[model samples]
Target: MWTKRYSEILLMTFMSITCTRAESEFELRDVTLHIIPANTVERNSELNLTCEVNVVSRGGNTPDLKISIFKNYNNHNPVYINNTRSNKVTYTIAKAQASHSGIYQCDVSAGNQHLYSSEENINVTGLQTPELRVDKLKVTEGEKVRVTCSAREESGVLEYTFKNGLKVIYKESSSSGVVQRFHSLTSTETAKFSCSYSIHVGNGVLHSSVSNEVHVVVEELKFTAKITILPSTEVIEGDSVYITCDVEGINKNSSVLSLSKGSRLLPRNYSTVVLANDSGVYECRAKVNSAERNAYKNLTVKELFSTPVLTITPAEVFEKESFNVTCRSSKIASERIGHDDVKYFIYRSNKMISSDNGIYKTMAKNETNGNYTCTAQVNNTIKWSQWITFTAKVLVSKPTITVLNEVILNKPFRIECRSDRGSLPISYTLKQNHTTLSHVQVSNPSQKAVFTTSIQSIQQISEFKCEAQNNGVNSAQTSDTLRAQVTVPVGKPNLITVPVEQDITENQQLQFLCGIPEGASSPITFKWYKEKNLSPVYVTTVNFTNAEYTILSVEGSHSGSFYCAALNKAGKEEVSNHVNVSVRMARWKKGLITGVCLMLVTGIVFAFVIRYRAMRVKVASSNGAGIWSVRPPVLDSSEVVDVDEPEEPNVEYTEVLHPQNSDPARVPLRKGTDTVYSEVQSTSPEFHDEF
Candidate 1:
């Protein structure tokens, strides 16, 4: 097992290296296959096939080119040893037979590419006939003779078939260890035996002509041997019986007599318990010199009950089908026991599936597939039937297909195909428009196969489907057809106006339509932009056929180059051709502007006229001050108008002063402390003095 795993690892590594270089970088050509000696060889001879290749090495020791040899059209795989790193490799077939003939070819692996070679035919003709022989030309009765059948010149694996008068009695492969066989004769008669051999060659078998026949004769010796049973030849099992042997027609002192029961030598008079197995031919042998004589008699011991057999109704049972199994004994010795005394039971593997009633019937299921055995019991004599295996074949169920995402044009998308129920080794095929895209065989029923494909055109997306088949490819169950339309890439968008005009006035409703060449299966997202701004002013997702961006009132802000972009499941953006839009004012707006200008001029003139009148109403004053008042303004005092100025203080000469009116403390000390000061009178009588 370890060796097998190591070989696998090596193979994987070699393949990895072989694929390291790009296919175009590989330089390989001129692979030729040659046959040695001649195109044809006789049987039991040697034939050689050589494959030669030419490869351009990549600036190193000769690139270790790998070569694979093949026979017929199975060129994808090598005949043996898979790949070998030899420029020229020879395949030798020793002891060649007709089975080894075929058209041969070779494949060369260099760098990363593979090259095919021309074909050559190798033919192996003729077969060696076998020889048959016997050790004795004549043998006494009840004696076994050694028979040898061989093909001395034939060396390879051959099948030896020994025949008795055109009827094959024994056949075995040459690889089997048995070389010589024994032929036993019970009655005095003449018999002929012959042999032939067959060899397996390229997809078929080749048989040689029958060999020459050898004849042998059996006769009774001069002194005969005899055997007798005391009770009877036929008896019930477990009954004791006596057997005796006697010799005649020779001196008793000279001839030796003995009894044998199937290779076991017994006394001249033998006694033992008779059993069902002991019911066979017993022999008595007498030997003198270089000759032996034998006599045989058949004994019959009845079995208490025969082995039970388990039978099925339908040999080939499939899942969910009804089937039955039962246990029954074909023979029950009525003399020993009645049929009702026996009981029957059935089992699956080691677990009993049926009770004493014997019959086990049910609808076959996947779990019911196993080995079944049956038994019959008569008290303690239980007999079992040989085991028989039953396996159910489950039909493939209808499959369902699902896509991983949406199918995009020119992009690989994954599609999963699955069958809910089926037997192992179910084959799945993916098809587009009835053309097979890919196929795979799944060993696990629960496993699903994934295939990658892309839609290059609209026609390629029509009707993709999956086929599930367990019986054969020709007979397959189909899944519900998946009709997938490709998510077409957003084509160059075409932006247009409602009236298809170049200019429009403000306050006028405008409609801008953003559309693609064709609709996509998935919703298309549209973006509308004006001028050279990187951001779109209006964005929406809808079918491109009916997508539009509308403006309730076309304004100066909307008066720029208008364009739109469209995006779909294709994951790409496409922009439309720019359409310039100009917005201008209406003629009615000019009159309204003129009227507002007249009102502004009248108001300014009126304000200026009022200011001039006010300036005229003002009066001048000497001090630079005055405006007109409600009453007349008073005159400035230049001379004494009302009363004469008070005369200068006459008392200035001797004005008396009140000393009690003056205080020395400036803060006027109070709080129950009286303090006073005298003051001198001033001559300014115009100013009254108060303390």
Candidate 2:
């Protein structure tokens, strides 16, 4: 035991200074001293000790540095005998005596700094091994064992120790001891009793030696029961585990073997089969005629699961149709559904779905059309299968189209295309007069697609149609054409006569020019209304067509509140504000009218303009604002006018050339063109100027 402890101390010292002395982490100025014969040696033996000094530069000696050696590491009062001074030096002691055993160190001085080396122990032993003897060679259990040790001469401290293998059973420390008494020797085998002595000399060194071993026998009965299992691997459910109990130093016939769990007795055998519920502390008992012993072993059980197979019924599915997916597991079917059983779960697109009986029956929706799988979980154990893809096909029907608003020439309107039954991402194509107008793709399967478009002319009845197609690659289904009519809507019309007054003379060339806003469909029919009645006037001499009502002459019967209504093929009509016409005198008194008469006519125009502005303001205030609004303007021919409202705030109008008419007889009148009839034209196609 002392030898082991000394080796451990040497190991700890070596670990503390494993690195070179120059590379020490703690900024200590020191030297490393290594002494030969680290432990005790016999007296009169040669020994050599070396001191290697590592110095910090403080302008002291370099190559020949001053280093002093001391005995017992006492630097305050140095010992002059066998002392030397040098950068590196080794001291040799030939035939060392007991007085030479002490700790040694080296020191170096630089200006006001001093460096010290670690102390090294040098032990010179003069003691001899003691003689050990026992009173008897054998002893019974509970008997006092006596061992005696003696040294040839008086030793400092004598230690007597008795050991069985590496375990110390008895020990005693005394000065010059002679005997050691051990009580109740119960060791199962023969033990060796040894004696040794450790004495510290006057120079701080301990000399020690071990005596010859004296073997003593201890008589005692030690019975043991050890259990062993055949298969060491973890035992799962439904597995048969074999357990064996071995009894030491007992004959099979003399000893009775029995197995037990808690208080219940099992089959009496050296080996037994372990059950699933038998997972607990099990004891194996060996009973002889007078002695009995038992040993315990722990048993545990684990659970496992089998893979699940997923199946689908009526594998093919249609849009808005129902389908079923069944996940069957033979393991689950064999095992009863207890609190510890695994529950089945179905997944579509990595999202869990409800299936009470492992049979997932659900309708085919957009969200439910993806790859599916299933998983089972019991406690912390879970297992899932690979994904199975499922795609649904939907039946497409013919698309029906209708105009959401009145479609006019050069006027924006919307045409809606709808499919009654189809999947999402359906494409819609709008055609006018057998030509493609716009193509729209509707992402939502349930919504209709609206396309805004306009017509250029109403020379012939325009035919429009819409078609829908599903986004399928193989034999993609398309819808039939839903035909519609593209007719222009009449804009708000303004009635303008030759004379801007209500009072007019007879026999004068009085013409009613219904100034329609530009971009109105051609061949518009006009109806002239009179005084307080909604019914139109029927005159035999006048013909009203092409937005113009020509009377060719004025009469007293026309003096009333006259308003006009314009209609086109769009099935919508627009009525103009009424103008009061008062025929007070014949043509002879027309020149004799006063300023008040002129003022009366002016007041009527003022009142009409004021009322129109009020209506526009009311419409803008009610809703945030609308696309069409007009303010009373200072009329001038040179100033550019605007009637068409911009949809966005950042947009400004720029002119583009309009396509010329193909018919020569119905050519539009321009300022440069001389035609048989006089026509008033506006610069912008959407805004018309009043005459």
Candidate 3:
């Protein structure tokens, strides 16, 4: 027995030494452990742990061993066991809790030898819970906003959750490596948001922080400014006008203000003041930080000015008369400065004749007659307010009259008057021995006044004077007076004849008479003349109203010439032309009975004588009487024969002297012829006896 027991002991001792050498060879190989499902834990879920081993084969690979997982490195508390004989192992904790979250180990054991073992720590995260945050607490609607969500206490990657009142509106993953941005968020979108995250941790799910709450105030963007114009009065050119722009209620603090004419901007200035050159509308604008506003205004400028105008009242005046004149002006403002102390000057002929405080005055005695003007002067220059013109006149003086000639009956004469030189109206008056004769008014301004009158038989005696008056003033009486003379005269009577003849016979007696009219006053002289020479034919110087003288008989001497003459107190006058008268003896005045008886007796006696003388002359002529003997013998004293002579001559003798013949023998015989013879008486007586 002893011998056999010793032999077994020796064999056991040899095997134990061989086993130790094999374990040392296996220890020289490298092994790695990896856990599945990461090292993080999540709440209300299972914890799955996977163990993996990476082995490097060194050339003695018998078979890959199986792996086992232990919780907290304890072999008795096995979380997983794998019998498949591989290098990887997996362990799962179902219904896991916060208490189950801890470090775990992976073990790979074959037979009774531990091949590989590794420990991994795991953290339990409540799930993939995410938190959200907003950078700004309050934001206007339609503004760009940022929403962020992150895992709690772990930052693997970031994501953003955008929601509107607990509703997921948008989501972006942090895998893009950029911050998520949301622009122009609405008011509803600024409410509560749901967010979650996933990160690389021990747990498969991610934990989120709290949900961020933000109040959103929707604000309407307002960009506005005001425009103000300075010195709001009547403005003129070349004057400065100031304009300003005031910005208000803008969205941004930093902005620019723009001023323009139409659309062009002017140089930079907040308040603009410029010398106005044109008149129109001006525009101003304000540009805020992304906002704009504008304003406009109109400006005007004037060119002309207003002043005072002058006028004159009652533009004319009379000479030497006291008349009121007035100067007037209009459109003068009642609030005019220093106008109450204005002075006016009255000017005539371009000379300042008078001056007054309000309107100028004229002298009561007019010195000159012409146009008068007025002007108002301020300082040295004349104001347009006062200027006017008017006309004036003067009066004339009275007149007096004088007479230069005397007036005669049935004659013509004239009178004259004189006056002083002036412009007033004047008239003249004529008087006869202080009694008014005629009154005449002279309208023209001439030198003298004259009147002409005639003297007739009706007015035998008259005296005259003249006076003149003008403007109620009379001139002195004239020194000269007119005189007159009166007289009467008669006319001579004319002579008449029966037969107008040149001469008269000697025996003819004509009648001559000197006479005048019954009422004629005359010392008349009646005388007859021959031709124009005076002959002593007849003369009668008699002063009688009706005187008559006669020349009873006229001879040849009265045929020479004849005329008459008459004289009066006026003058002496003669007969008109001339008259001639003739006278002769009457032959028919003898008695007719005596003339017849004497004619018969003378015839008878002449017959007897002629017979006696013829008987004797016949005896003588029978005896042949010669012519000398027939001349009867001259009778002697004894031989004278007696002839009976009657008491009156038998015939009247008429002078029968013929101028051409003077011989008496050539006288023709008066009666019968002379003859004596007796023979035949005897025979006649015897015959008577026988019967």
Candidate 4:
């Protein structure tokens, strides 16, 4: 046994020496181990380990090669041991857990030979929960606010995450603390803030916790001063503009406010009726105690449309000559190059001839002799330009002289000079028998001159002529001569009726006279007619020069229509207005006849009264009683043969006697008589029944 033991030890020692030699040789070969990603990784991340050799020992009598991966956490045991056919090998962990983080090593072997590489370490940290704190709970507008974040516990490495209402604002990793700052705060900036801290423990394992949420509020600044502009910024020309500055949340009496246009300070706190020249950027500043506030705005003012300029080429043109006329806008308006801001119009003789287009062309004619004007406007704007007038000068025609009234030997007459066409301010000269009679100037081309003179003092056959001259610079512009014939003056006569008495007696004579209104002209005769259709029945005699007609005895047959006519030596006859003559008796005569009739009726009534008295006395004496007997008129039997008797007579009677006592049945007797009687009794049955 001893001898066998010794031989086995020697064989093992020799093999060990051989293995050491091979290990030494293999160790000399370049070998390296590398992690696939970075050595440091987040939790739950994949990891890979790779081992490579520069060259495999193929010359030596070596066995098959294999790669083994070892971890420090597993008692330095091999986590991955596999034989490889190539010089390089890789080990992968698809999902790395925290337990996989440790020191790692790879061993390279050929058969029973092996070598270990340098060790690599991977670490994992637990994330710490954070606490957020602020210097203040609220902040003022335009003021700065500060915030801070602190880790809950001491951690390996903490990453502080801060957000403003779910939006990540700041992210930083540090072993210490973190802070956030806000320079300015606005009214709309109201949000909650939270912070969280995290760390990687091992194998990409992440641990985190949220801090208590903190909210911040921003308040609007205090009210100070405000500015208001009246009538808006955009305005047309001549618009009333105003600006007012008011100080609020403070006392106006203690505050000083100033309004300015550019750098020039205004005197008043408010401006009224500002003009376009005042258009510019304005500022309103208010100062109370030491606080100052300012407001600014830009003011714009539009200009009113300007008067258009009219220009006609070839200033003076003759008939049938073509000319061009152009209307242009103001210089300030034309500078607006790209906009259709202005429109033009052309006027001739105060009437619209063209619109929109500024250029106008026309052939010269008598009809185009009047004034021309133009205007411009814009769309949706009330601005308009003033109308400009320019009179167009043109060539004229010859003048014509006319005699206005009849010419007499010793009377004054009128002569008018006229021209068909020309510009205003024309000169006219009147001539008689080729001698200058009078010179006159007419401002209007259409007007003429009237010359009143008598030819009695001058020579006979005084032929009148007139010449017209234009007012233009060209002296050659003149008119042809026009002639007038002279003749004796003859009047158109009118006859008038002479006034006559309205009332006339039947035997009274009536007379009428017809005379000319212009007084009688020599060699003129008058004639009278009874009606319009018949010829003159009476002609003026030697004594009746004015034409008078008389009736010896006026009667109703003389009432008829009458008219008169006057005829001159020139054979021109003129008739007077028709007159109707009516003959009437005097009204006093009718009154006298009515008075005579009244006198006769009075006399008849007096005689009737006398007769009635006589009859009453005779009837009274013939009767013995005081009763009266009214006897009806005796009629023939043929007149009253079948007449019906009336029940009672319509006649009434009075009692002359009265009773002494108050008894109606008894009648008192007269002083001389002893008899007493009642009222008279009627013989008819109707009287008894009525009683």
Best-fitting candidate, scored by TM-score:
1
Score each candidate by Cα lDDT: 0.75, 0.62, 0.52, 0.63
Write one digit per residue (lDDT tens) for candidate 4, span 240-283: 77887777876789778888887788764565554446678888
Clashing residue pair totals per candidate (backbone < 3 A): 2, 3, 26, 11
Best by lDDT: 1
Candidate 2 residues lying further than 4 Å off, grouped into runs, are 1-233, 237-305, 309-391, 431-439, 445-447, 458-463, 471-482, 489-691
Q: Per-residue lDDT tens digits of candidate 1, residues 228-332?
A: 986999987557889998888878677788998888888999998765777888899877643567899989988777778899878766677899998888887
For residues 1-691, could you state the per-residue lDDT of candidate 3 as single tens digits?
Answer: 9989999999899999988776654321434555445566466456666665554433555344666676665778776777753555556666444435556776665554565555678666553344555666565544555666554443335555666666667766674423444545544333554455444434444435545554554454455766766675345433456767667775334657766666556543433333233456767777653345678877674421122333343343445455554443332333432455455666656776666553545543545444556655433434333334444533444444444454433445567765655443556778776877776677776545677765555343446666665545433334345443332223455554533344544445355444556544345555555567745456666667434335555554555546555555434454534555444434453345568777887787778866755544322223221222122456786334445534332221112222234334332333234222211112234333442
**Is candidate 2 or 4 superior in lDDT?**
4
Task: Please give the range of 10 consecutive residues that has the lowest summed lDDT in model 3.
Answer: 649-658
Residue ranges of candidate 3 with Cα displaced over 4 Å: 1-332, 337-339, 358-367, 378-420, 445-453, 456-462, 473-623, 626-691
lDDT score of model 1?
0.75
Angstrom error at residue 493, model 3? 9.3
Alpha-carbon deviation at 173 in model 1, angstroms = 82
Residue 23 CA displacement from its true place in model 4, Å: 12
